[model samples]
Target chain A: MSLDFGLIIEQMPDILSGLWVTLWIWVVASILGAALGFLVAAARRYGPAPLDWLLKLYVEILRGNPFLIQLFLLYFGGPFIGLRLEPIPAGLIGLTIYASAYFSEIFRAGFQAVPRGHVEAAQCVGLSRSQILRRILLPEMTMLVLPQCVNMAIILIKETAILSIITVPEMTMVIGAIGSQQYAFVDAMFLLAIFYWVLVEICDWLGRRAEAKLSKFRFAVT
Target chain B: MSFKLFELMLWAAGYTVVLSAISIVIGLTIGLCVCAAKLARSRALSIPATVFISFFRGVPLLVQLLLIYNLLPAIGISVPSVVAAVIGLSLCTAAYQAENLRGGFNSVPKGLLEAADMVGLSPWQQLKRIRAPIALRLTLPALVNEAILILKASSLISVVGVIELTRMAQNLSASTYRPLLFYSVAGGLYLVICWTVAGGGALAERLTRTSRA
Candidate 1:
C-alpha cells in the first residue's frame, strides 16, 4: 500500500483535537503539581516527625513508581475504590501526583540553596517563621527553582501522552487510532512526533525566557 | 486475594530487575557510540548525531515506544512487542547517556590529552588508558542517575503489553480489586531498586575518595 498524504492531512483536525486535550491535561496537572510540590517541600523541611515521614513516603512512592502504573491505578482501579473517575480526571490526578514528587525535589534543592544567613537575618529582624518563609526564603529560592520547575513542566507535558493508554484520546492514542484505521501507521506516527516536537520546542523556548528572567535575580545575589 | 497478590508482586519484581538490566546494558553500549559520534571531527557525522540525540531526548519514551511498536508492523517488520520496547527504551537511554558522556569527555583536561600525545600513545590506546578511566570517574554520578531514570522509564514498556512489574501490578489489581496493596508492593520494589542504585553510587564515591587519599 502506498502512502496517502491526502488521508493523513484529512485527519489533522482529529489529531489536533487530541493534541489540545493533551495540552489541557498538562497545564492543569502542572499547576496542581507545583502547588502540591511546594506543600510537600515545606512539610519535609519543617513539619513534625510523622508528617515529615509521611511526606517523604509520599514523594518516594510517587517518584519510584512509573507514571503508567499510577495512571492505571487512578483510571482503572478508581472504580474499585468507589471513585469512578473519567479518563481525563484520572489522567490529571495521576500526572499531578507524579509530577509533584519530582517538583518537590526541585523545590527542596532550591530551598536548600537559599543562604542560611538570609533566614537568620530575617530571624534577627524579629520576623515570624511564616513571614520569613514567605518574604525572604521564597523570593530567594524562586530564581533557583524556576528553571527546574519549567523543565519539569515540559516533562509533565510529554508524560501526558501516557494517558492515551487509559483511552484518554491524547495525541498518541489519536494517532494510533488513525493509523490502525488507515493502515498508514508510519506517516501518522511521524506526524504525531512532529506535533510533540513542536510542543517541546515551544516549552523549551518558554523555559529559556523564564531562565533568563530568573538568572538576573540570581546574578544580583551572587 | 492477599496470597495471590503477594505471589504476583514477587514475580513482577523479578521481571522488573531483568528488563532493567537488559535496557541498561543496551543503553550504555549505544550511548557510548552515540557520544563518540557526537564528538567526532566530521560535521557530516556529528550533525546527524546531534539531531538524533536531541530528537530522542526531547520526545517522551511512551510515545516513542508506541510509535515503534505500532509502526514497525505496518512496515512488515513485525518484531515482538518486547523487542520493540527494548529498542525504543534503549534508544532513549542512549540519547540521555550520550549527553552525560559528552559532559564527561568535556571534563577531561586538555593538558591530559597533550600529555598522552607527547607519550606517542595511539588514539585508541589513549582513549582506553587515559580518557576512559577519567571520563568514567567524572561521569559515574550522572551515569548512576541515568540508570535510576532508566529503571523508572522501563515501566513505560508495559504499555505495549510487556507484562513487567507495572503490568503485573495492573493484572493483580484487576484480579483482586486491591489497587492499593498491589500498587504499594510494586512501588516498594521500585524504591528498593532506586535506593540500591543511589546507595551503591554513594559507596563507590566514598571508596574512590579513600583510594585517592
Candidate 2:
C-alpha cells in the first residue's frame, strides 16, 4: 500500500495531545534535573570527603545502567518501598534522575576546568566562598557547560519517548495506541517521527541562541 | 532473586550483549560508508548522506524502531521483531558513528597528507598509511564511548519484543511479583557489563597507544 497523508491529518488531535504531554514532561524533568545536577556537582566539589565519595557512587550507578531499568525500578518497584506514584510522576522522576546523572558529570567537568589560578586569585582578593562561587565559578562553568547541557537535554527529549512504555500517554504511546487500533502503524510512525524531529530541532535552535548569548560572558571573563 | 531466576536474567543478558555486538559491527561498517559519502565532494553523494544523518540523529531511536517494525509490512517487506530491532539500533548508531568518524577524518592534518604526496604516495597509499591510521587513533575514544552508549540503549529493543535483559527483568518480575528484587538485579547486571566493556575499551586504547609509540 502507498503512504497516506489523510490518515495523519485525521489523527492530528491525538498527536497534538500526545505532543503536549511530551513537552510538559520534557520541560519539567529537564529543569529539575539541571537544578539537581548543579547541586550534586557543587556538593561533590566542596562537600566533605565522605559525602563526595557517596555522591560519586550515586553518579556512577545511575550512569552505568540503562535508564529503562531505572524507570522500572522507580515505577514498578515503588510500591514495595511504599512510594506509589502515578505514571506521570514516575516518568518525571525517572527522567529527572537519569538526566541528573549525566548533567552532573557535565557540570563537574565544567566546574573543574575553571583553572585553579582563577579560584586562587579570587581567594587572594579576600572574596568570600559564596562570592567566589557566584561571581567567578558559576559564570565560567555556565558558559563551558551550556552546550553540553543542551546536548543532554536533546538526549533527554528522546528519552521522554520511553516513558510511553510505562503508559505515560506521551507521543510515542499515543501514536502506538493509534497504530494498533487503526492498523495505520506506518502513518502513526510517520507522525511520531515528525513530532520528535521538530522537538529536537527546536531544542537545538534554543541551545545555539543561548550559546551565543553566553559567549559574550565568556569573552568578558577571559 | 532465586538461582533459577538469576540464571534466566543472565541468559537474557546474553541477548543484550550479542545484539549490541552485532549492531555495533554493522553500524561501524555502515558508518564508514556514510562518513565517506558525507566527506565526498559530489553533491549527489553528500546530500543523501547529510539527510540520512540528520533524520537519524534528529529523530528518537524509539520512533525509528517503531517505524521500522511497522513500515516494513506496509512496504511488503515484513521482518521479525529481532531483525527490526537490529535495523533500528544499527541505523541509529550508524548516524552518530558516522558523525564521529567524519569529525575524526576532518581532523587529520593537511600537512601530513601533503607530505605523503611529496613522497609520491598514491591517494590509496596515503589513506592506508597516513589518513586511516591517524583518523582511527583520533576516533578510538569516541568509538568506545559510542559502544557503551549503544550497549545501554540496547534496553530499548524490548519495546519491539526482543526479550533482552530489560525485557527478561520485566517478565521475571511480573511472574514472581517481586519487581524490586528483579529490577535491582537487572540494574546490577547492567552495571557489571558496562564497567567490563569500559575496562576493555581502556585496555584497548592503552595497547594501541603503546604499540604506536
* Full-model lDDT for every candidate: 0.84, 0.90
True contacts kept of 1: 0.55
Locate the minimum summed-lDDT window of 10 residues in model 1 chain B.
Answer: B204-213
lDDT of 2 at A125: 92
- Give candidate 2 misplaced runs (Cα > 4 Å): A124-126, A216-222, B210-213
Output the number of the TM-score-best candidate: 2
lDDT of 2 by residue, A27-99 (tens): 9999999999989998998899999999999999999999999999999999999999999999999999998
lDDT tens per residue, model 1, B148-172: 8888898888878998888888887
> Which model scores highest in DockQ?
2
Q: Which of the numbered candidates is closest to the native, going by highest lDDT?
A: 2
TM-score of the second chain, each candidate in turn, equals 0.92, 0.96
lDDT of 2 by residue, B19-105 (tens): 999999999999999999999999999999998998898898888988998788778897889999999999999999999999988
